[model samples]
Structures are given as structure tokens and as C-alpha cells.
Target: MSESRSGYILLGLSALLAFSYLMAGWGLPVEYPGTVALKASGILLLAVYAARRNAYLLAMALALSAIGDAMLALGPSRMTLGIASFGLAHILYAWIFLRVLRLRGMRGGMGYAMAGLLAVFGVAILIWLQPGMGELRVPATIYNGIIMVMAIIACLSKARWLAVIGALLFVASDSLIALDLFKDYDPAWRGPAVWISYVAAQFCLTLGLIRERP
Candidate 1:
């Protein structure tokens, strides 16, 4: 089979595994295994196909994200590991954004401003519900901040508009997850929106990097 065909196959299998895990519901060991398999396969494909510096960086970010997913599958008893893994993933994402910014000769002023504003707004809302969501305030705040920063950086980068839009959608996905976890807002729309946006974000970023390759 052609490399492109293999890439697509890997990508498809990864998506299938992730979807299977998502549908497996809470309190199931199968979910974690499926998620881990999906993520590992996804990252392996991405790394093999990534042909540029930016693409490689994005692949690294995704790999870190996979680590976070695996940690989450370890269940709430290992919540600290999950959170730390995601936190490190965000740091990797930050590095990716910074590299893009440097390549495009873009400053981070706008991104910083946007992130600050969103952080304030999100924190305010979280604080208002602190009596109920007190345990989640800190983690939610950190996650939101990372997302906002990522979106802003994506917007300012020289990458394709699709990539920027994908980044925004990713932010929306994570925001929904946080809301569901913290505020009991488990809207049925959250699952599809989150996964679709996430996959799109990865695809767009990958394509953008490929296009920019020398």
C-alpha cells in the first residue's frame, strides 16, 4: 500500500479506537485501553508522516495529549497524574506556538491579551459557582488559560486559516469538557463537538505544516 493510504488507514483506526473508548462509558477498564491504543497509534502515524519542523512539533503536542488521555483512563484515583500529564502537554503546545510565532515574526501581545481576558471571565464564572465546583476551580482555570493562549497563538501564526479555526474549535471542545466536569452541564452536544473539533484541529495543523514545508 502507498504511504498515503497507510496514513489514512492509521488515522481511521485511531479515530475508531478513540470513539470506542468514548462510548464505553465511565467505570470501565476497556475504555482506558482503547483510548491508549488509539492515541498511541495516532501519534505514531503523525510522527511518521510529519515532514516539517512545525508538523513534528504538532505531533509532539498530540503525543503529549495522548499521555494525558492515558492518565485520565487510569481513573480519578490517579487524577493528579492525569492533570499533570495534560499540564505538560499544554507546555508542549506553548512551545509549538512559540516556534510558529518565531517563524512568522509575530509577537504574542494579542494572544496574551485575549488569554488574559478569557482567563478573567472564566475564573469569574467558576468563582460564582465555587460553592459547588470548588474542587475544580484550580484545574479548570489552568486548562482554560492554556487553551486561550493556544488559540491566540494559532490565530497569530502564519499557518492556514483552517488551522486557526481548528485551534478555536479545540478550545471550544475543552471548554465544554470543563463545564461538564465542573458545573454539571452535560449537554449531549459536548461529545461530538469535542471529538470532531479535536480531530479537525490535528488534521488542519498537520496539513498546514505540510504546506509550509520546503
Candidate 2:
């Protein structure tokens, strides 16, 4: 296989490991070691694919994500730290998406239309269920709205199906997690779906990056 393909395969493996670790209830401390390995490996592979563009930025984003994962697994005591890490990761992702959008040029009205629709749906659902959401309702709703916008913006930047799907899946995964936080859900099933979708989203996104013109 070509080196590019090999890099994707390695990234896929790293994502798989992350999913497995989450499923096993390894928590932050136990999961940190494995996540560190996976993230480092993923960064290395992506570095090979980087050619004088936004590669370093992408690597930094993944590294931030890894740190967030570790903080989350470590336990509840580090919730603030975990949120901070993940927040930075999201910012990094936003930057990368912005770069991609600039390179591809902004899409016209259709893109904005799609984003507006997503926002409407997201906000409507949140509003309808606000009472049930309690403390998490507002924050979850706001975050989802931002992410949906980001997803749409990311999609508009490129025609790659992988990138679009990845962005959508990310929205789905986070939405599920928010629902779980606010309401009662079957943890056994919900947990796996969330992590699996999360991993898939990341894989699709990174793959899209690798496929971009250097």
C-alpha cells in the first residue's frame, strides 16, 4: 500500500484503540497511557502527510484532543481541565476548517441555507426539551449550535464526502452525549455508540485532511 494509505490505516487503528479504552471503563488514569500512545502515533502519521501547509496545526489539534481524552478518563476531579483541553481542540479544529474554507473558497447561499437549517433544528429541539435538560440544557444547546455551524462551514469548504460525513457524525455523537447528560439513558448501549461515532468522526476528518491538496 502507499504511504498515505498506511497512515490512514494507522490512524484508524489509533481511533479503534481509543474506542476500546472508553468501552472498557478504563477511566482517565488507566486510559491515559494508551491514549497517549495512540495520539502520538496518530500525530506522527499525520506529520508524514503534512506538506508545508496546515499539517502542524492539525497535529496540534489531535494532541489537544488526546490530552482532553486523558483528562476525562483520569476522573471527575479534572473535569475543568478536561473541558479546557477539549475546548482548545475545538478551536484548533475551527482554525483548520477555516484554512480549508479559505483554500476552497466560500460556497454561496446554499451553504448558508444549510447551516441555518441545522441551527434551527438544533435550537428547536433544545428549546422543546429545555425543562428536561436542567443544568445541561442551555450549555448543550449552545455547544451543539456552534458545532453544527462549524460542521456546515467545514462541509462547504470541500466537496469531500468524508469530511461532510465526519462533521455530521461529530454533531451526532456530541448530541447523544448531551442527551445522556441531561436525561436518563441506557449507559451500556449509549456509551459505545457515542465513542464509536466520535472515533469515526475524527477518522473521517483526518482522512479528509490527508486527501486535501498540499
Model 1, runs deviating above 4 Å: 22-44, 51-54, 107-133, 210-214
Measured by TM-score, how close is model 1 to the native structure?
0.72
Candidate 2 structure quality by residue, lDDT tens digits, 1-214 = 9765775666666655565556456454545556545434543444444432356766666666667666665666765575566566666666677777888887667767767777777777677667676654444555555576677677667546686677778778877766665555556678778877877777777776654544
- Candidate RMSDs in Å, in order, are 4.3, 4.4
- List per-prediction Cα lDDT, in the order shown: 0.62, 0.64
- Deviation (Å) of 186 in candidate 1: 1.1
Give the per-residue lDDT of model 1 (tens digit) for 1-214.
Answer: 9877876776676666555555555444564455566544554455456632346566666676666666665667766676666676666666666666777755366655655665566566556556555666667567656766666666666556676666666666666666766768877777767666766666665665554433
Model 2 scores a C-alpha lDDT of 0.64
Q: List the residue pairs that clash in candidate 2.
A: 27-73, 28-73, 28-74, 29-74
Model 1 residue 30 CA deviation in Å: 5.9
What C-alpha lDDT does candidate 1 achieve relative to the native structure? 0.62
Tell me the TM-score of each prediction against the true structure: 0.72, 0.73
